[model samples]
Target: MDARRGWLRFIGRRLNPLTLAAARRGSAPFTIVRHRGRRSGTIYETPIIVARRGPDFAAELTYGQSVQWYRNIRAAGGRCELARGDEGWQIESVESLPVAEGLAAYGPPRSWVLRLLRRHEFLLLRVEGSGGDASD
Candidate 1:
């Protein structure tokens, strides 16, 4: 597990810059997630894949729930900003979803791939003005 984490860290450092650049250019499947660090309060922009689910958004927890971004988001009261394509949205709330429900939102291909990869953890992000239910 340590080796895998090391490898991922090495790769992420190299790939994140490029991914961030592409994501800013309105690229498909990539969104720029802007979050503030829980302790340092430093703002961070991370590139991730987000899928639309009704007026909300869904994302696979590819690196699990312990990732810094996820922690930061939670620490910030589940509020963040997501930039996708030429559009941007202020995420009002975020909640963990049951695997089955999350998978259903993803539909085919992505859901299948995620299932195959054993990525069962997912999050639902409700846009601020989307009128989506933000309650637990």
Candidate 2:
């Protein structure tokens, strides 16, 4: 694995459980992404930092775009489950957004220094549930 991906694996594997727990309890800046594995078909739950962007949700590709969850989301035809608090929303569209536009939608970072080290790729996940649970 690449350096950043390695680091993310090291930390995320151990800490994501707690993060997912906190996110499920309605913690700020944390949300749970539920996706199916592309090849294995096993379901996985990953915790991500999501920001509201218009009618969609924005998540930074901090460890680059090669992460399994990112790829799985795309390979699954942009369909996934997003959990915030006690509710889970279905997503239909998962596309990359330009860094500047994503940053604008996500708002100014608390640390500009950290901002400089981030990747340009960001995913904009469009919620599919409108009046019902499966309509986008």
- Best model per lDDT: 1
How many angstroms is residue 34 displaced in model 1 relative to the true structure, after the best TM-score fit? 0.3
Q: What is the lDDT of residue 47 in candidate 1?
A: 90
How high is each candidate's TM-score? 0.91, 0.84
Window of ten residues with lowest summed lDDT in model 1: 127-136
TM-score of 2: 0.84
Cα error, candidate 1, residue 69 (Å): 0.4
**Model 2 misplaced stretches (Cα beyond 4 Å):** 1-5, 110-114, 129-136
Global lDDT of each candidate = 0.88, 0.80
Clashing pairs in 2: none
- Candidate 2 residue 39 Cα shift, in angstroms, is 1.3
- Residue 4, model 1: lDDT of 70
Give per-residue CA lDDT, model 2, range 1-136, as digits (tens). 8897688887787899899889989887789999999999999999988888766787888778788899999899999999989878899878777677677767766225336776577777888954322232
- Per-residue error (Å), model 1, residue 11: 3.4
Each prediction's RMSD over C-alphas, in Å, is 1.8, 3.8
